[model samples]
Target: MKIRVSDLISRKERSKKIDYKFEIPKFEFEGDVITPVSKCEVSGVITSDKDIVIMKAKVTCTLEMNCSRCLDTFIYPIDIDIEERFANNNSLENEDVIIVLDDILDIAQVVESNIISSLPIQRLCKSDCKGLCQECGANLNKESCSCNNDDVDIRFDVLKGFFDNKEV
Candidate 1:
């Protein structure tokens, strides 16, 4: 997913467009699994300006995820538009810039960053999805647990018996 910026770096603008499809495998990040379905299609225009490369990308893909409530697998479609600026060699004094990449910027990396950025702050199957029960470990959405909510503490009874025996 690397694009050669030779033409863009020459300070000459070119009306070049290319279409590409890429597949991103399942990966784990910060204990969350990211499974992307199908290869993302990224088609865009790369324009060369004075000491800068202008890129406008339109990408489409699907993200596969499991419901935290019912543990069911689900897919979410993703479509995004990316506009970025890249600096040419010896164009700027400092390397640290708002630009994405200065040399042979990896398109895959760009797409990955975009996908990660677009992710939901919190993902749920539904708005009222009942999570799993703590005691019986049952999915409350499908069925209810038999455990009583007002159960008394059995440990306190054991302590009471121990205190009674000490009195004897």
Candidate 2:
């Protein structure tokens, strides 16, 4: 959501608190589109200290994603704390700080960044997912397969013969 901070920038008040709710549509990342299962809410206070504006917010949302192991779809809840600093002056050399432009603060970019960064590296449907069987492409978590475990590929039989001829 784009918030116009012109009032906050011009006002004499040093600090202000604002609450916001937004519906973030599905966003694509790494060729995968993730959609939110519920509305996202953010509440925070903006404090001005000299020429710097500090914004602290808490964001909450539920998103739908596919499991990395089993490729199953599931819901994931996110609750993260966001802290950002905006500088009213341009002479600051810190690259981490955001520069306010036209007295506007577009919080949608911030929210998206936080949500993406907070996501787990590997998404799993369950804690102990057995994954798909390599032999017959069966789901190991569902049932047992008929493929034999002791069977070896015929291409490697020459190596097996060397082991059988060993004295040991």
Candidate 3:
């Protein structure tokens, strides 16, 4: 996962080829609202092409999260494809290359960056999901509760009484 900068190739030096592989434990992140399960698998190959290095990575994992609306726990799937390049020697980017590393580049850092960066700003189970009812504390998705629906808003009772008092 770690590479030696001196071992890499540069226009001035002659280290033309490099390859490596390794595995690390799953990562965990804790937030105030939710704690994501750390079950991830990452693998990839690094190929050095002269002054440029090509890194192809595939990550697959699952996270246990609570549904934003109902607060029910559910399994969430994760999959991502990422490609990164490191450049050797400080040269202008006009030469069809990018990201030249100083001496060594950390693959774990790259993978971590991709995972955290790609996450949705706001995680939600669905677009049109109706959350749990504040009154009676019932999940709106499952079944209707016996609790008075009008209890959702007390202000509506004033209107309800006015209409009831009207003689038809």
Candidate 4:
């Protein structure tokens, strides 16, 4: 995706309707692999106001990701709303607006960036997902393991024997 904004810049078209579907490869983010399972669909409008071009679009896609706790593969649906500003002329300030190069708006990078930003920091399959057990490497959500999890410090052994003799 690249869209030509010359029509808007030339004042021939006030707005441009964009409807496109594209594919993206797997992305490595935060030590996790995000694989796109569906085509990314972007639908929105680009409007020109004076020398500034504004693009508002909704991006949608399904991604295959792993659960952070248990490392199980799962599908993660993503929907991102993007609003970007571009400057067609040199008179506008360059800090906030992306400068249009050769009258084209390359939206691939923008869409990809939005998708990456929208991902959750911690991906979970469920709210109460029981992760894997540390002792027997068992999936806690599936089965229980007889692993002794009560850890006591060696420095408290003298106190433990003293407390065991007291009835209170």
Clashes of each: 0, 0, 3, 0
lDDT ranking from best to worst?
4, 2, 1, 3
Residue-wise C-alpha lDDT for candidate 1, range 45-133, written one tens digit per residue? 87776666677889899988767667666787889998776665664637443353456767788777887788776666777887777
The candidate scoring highest on TM-score is 4
lDDT of 2 by residue, 86-155 (tens): 8756775375678776667787777888899888888877899877777887778788898776667889
lDDT of 2: 0.79
The candidate scoring highest on lDDT is: 4
Ranking by TM-score: 4, 2, 1, 3
TM-score of model 2 relative to the true fold?
Answer: 0.81
Give the TM-score of each candidate.
0.73, 0.81, 0.61, 0.84
List candidate 3 segments past 4 Å from native: 10-39, 88-102, 126-128, 146-168
- Model 3 is weakest, by summed lDDT over 10 consecutive residues, at 15-24
Off by over 4 Å in 2: 93-95, 148-168
True lDDT of residue 54, candidate 3: 72
TM accuracy, model 3: 0.61
lDDT of 4: 0.85
Q: How high a TM-score does candidate 1 get?
A: 0.73
Model 2, residue 27: displacement in angstroms? 1.1
Clashing pairs in 4: none
